[model samples]
Target: MLVSLARVASESGWVRPIVDGSDVLEIAGGRHPVVEKALAASGEGPFVPNDLSLDGQRRLLILTGPNMAGKSTAMRQAALITVLAQAGSFVPAARARIGVVDRLFTRVGAADDLARGQSTFMVEMAECARILNQATPRSLLVLDEVGRGTSTFDGLALAWAIAEQIHDVVTARTLFATHYHELCDLAAEKPRALNLTMSVSEVDGRVVFLRKIVPGAASRSYGIQVARLAGLPDAVLRRAREILANLEAQEPADHRHKQLPLFEAHKSAVEEALGQLDLSRMTPLEALNWLADQQKKLR
Candidate 1:
């Protein structure tokens, strides 16, 4: 547990107290202590230098950026720094002024716990609930990918509500990282709540992560490029693009929205048509054209 705690400390940096109405968790230039140390023993250039700080007027920091852009690492590093500083050790950062937190809670990512038979998402909610129930004003909570198990609206609703609860009710310092860029709007009302983002660059169709943290939410998540990076097949990528296009054209999910019923009706019509099709009488080429025409009509 100590080893794990130390690693967490190295990955997350410190959360300093609010000074002059500006709350900033100061992080001076430092490599990922654990990650860099290992790479150095094998002789490699270290990660870049960066600084980040948040004030009381900004009690919460929402992080956004493309996958593998070091958003997760930076979030973890900030949290880790807070833990180490509170534990009375010299932080991995060159300088930091962390508020004294009574407890440090984190829900970083969902992973299968086969022994417990819980789905990855279920485990995520369970950890979040623990933080909500137990965290105090002096606590520091780090959450990553909250509400990832469910549909878009469901996930966004849950994430929004949880952040509100932590800020309005629990009043704990929070670092929330999510793919839902929409949540950045919360900063408008929650002055104590702010958005932070990681930097990214493209070179020869490849992504390079700057690993630096800056103020404000990101505008894009670049899911397709990340999917390509994961080795998604060409056909699958094409299909994903089509689905994304359709979703973008669709209305937002809300109780007042009537588009969902329209979509369902369209799906039902397609199913009926398929059921009634004379497959034995049609040529393969004819069948393919028929399906394509049907799909086009839905759009």
Candidate 2:
């Protein structure tokens, strides 16, 4: 087994990762070893190499990208590299610096354990509970599409809460890949949260997956294009497009508003006060008075 490991490492041009004691992770030009081997056997184009970095200030990566854009592959490779390094094997990367992880947790794919009488969402939540309860500051977690088995609002809410708990309480290094673009908001408020997405481009109205990780969130999921690629009937696809448009049109322009209770009543006075406030020109005293007035109105 050792010989085979060494041989594959040499053949694949894998590198010995630096086992640093610091709470940091750095990988440069990382590629999925299995995918690389498959491409090599088929004489296809080389895999695209992408870089990843996480540290004390930026420990959680919220990865958002379109379906079939290699989000899962990239996240899995990170965990795999850690496994290889701890097992005394070279990793598939140009360079790597890995910290010692006490525990490795992954919630990647959906599977129901029928014998246990648990549904897919039940299994997902069970695993998630374990991760939340067991993972520590030195643990590594790769969670892909948590809370995806439920309604959109419920799923988004659960995803948001899980992310916050991991960031604020567990402080574990995590690679979270999701179709929920709204989760990207965590990066704005949390110092240790960062956003990443797989690069994609359009060529003559067709979607192309670049399979390269880049900074920032993806603008859209491109689900319709993926369904089209899956050979869905033209009529069905057209209907789906229309329904998607109508749903999106009903969504609030601000993602934050979506979190508000669906039946919450809007206050015209509060709205008017917000619109009338000119923060740039207001003095501190004036600002205080305005806030007091608004507070009184609410009462």
Candidate 3:
């Protein structure tokens, strides 16, 4: 095993990580090994490398970005490098010096246990509960889109509270990726929390993913633009843009008191119309028809 690791490291230009007993993590130009290898094999340019710095003082990172911006990739690479160092294998990093992590916890993606009658949100909360109860100062955590399966306000509240708990109590090194851009307010409230974002750029009026993690909160989720890129019907994209603008106009000044779900409390005619939609099974043509019906109702 040792011989094979050495050979791979030599071939891949990997570096030796310093795994001394410190309570800090400092990684320079860290790359995801599997991704780098795949990129090389596929001739898909080069995998972008990123740096990470975490310690007792600044252990929580709030990562916000649009979809497919490489937030999960960055989080996975950091965890893999630390684990590889502990396993006595060279890591894919220019330099690495991290303490021994007692445990590694991750809560990313979505899943459900319908056979057992557990909803997606229930499963998400259960895994999050495990992290909250078990993780410690020496633990490493990677979380993504916490509280996303629920309503907007509910999700924001839960995500905010969980981030606070992790920073104040667990004190673990955490990389949290979320769509609730409101959570970025932690930089002012929590001294130990830092905001980071996956960088993207606009080229020729098109969004180009830079695949680099930079310090600061993202201004927007860019969900509409991303959806358009995914080839959603033109009619659907137009309706989405309209709804987004309406919601933005109604959003509260304080992010914590976010607007309630569109169909709750004060219902806009459009939202009330959309609320009746069974989007899960709706065909594009049906969706277009629904939108036409809603527009006629408004008129």
How well is each residue in 60-178 modelled by candidate 2, as lDDT tens digits? Answer: 99999999999988988888898998898999999999988898999978899999899999999999999999999999999999989999888887888899899999999999999
Model 3 lDDT per residue over 1-299, tens place: 99999999999989999997788888999999999899899998999999999987888999998888889899999999999999999999999997999999999889999998889999999999999999999999999899999987788878888998999999999999998887887875688999999999978756788999899999877888899889999999999989988877876564424444421334566876677888999999999998888778778
Output the worst ten-in-a-row residue range by lDDT, candidate 3. Answer: 256-265
Candidates sorted by lDDT, best first: 2, 3, 1
List of clashing residue pairs for candidate 2: none
Ten residues in sequence with the least summed lDDT for candidate 1: 14-23
Over the stretch 133-219, how does candidate 1's per-residue lDDT look in tens digits? Answer: 999877778899898988877788789889888889887778889888877877865767888888888798667777777777888
Give the candidate number with the greatest lDDT. 2
Candidates 1 and 3, the one with greater TM-score: 3
Error of 1 at 291 (Å): 54
TM-score, cand. 2 vs. native? 0.87
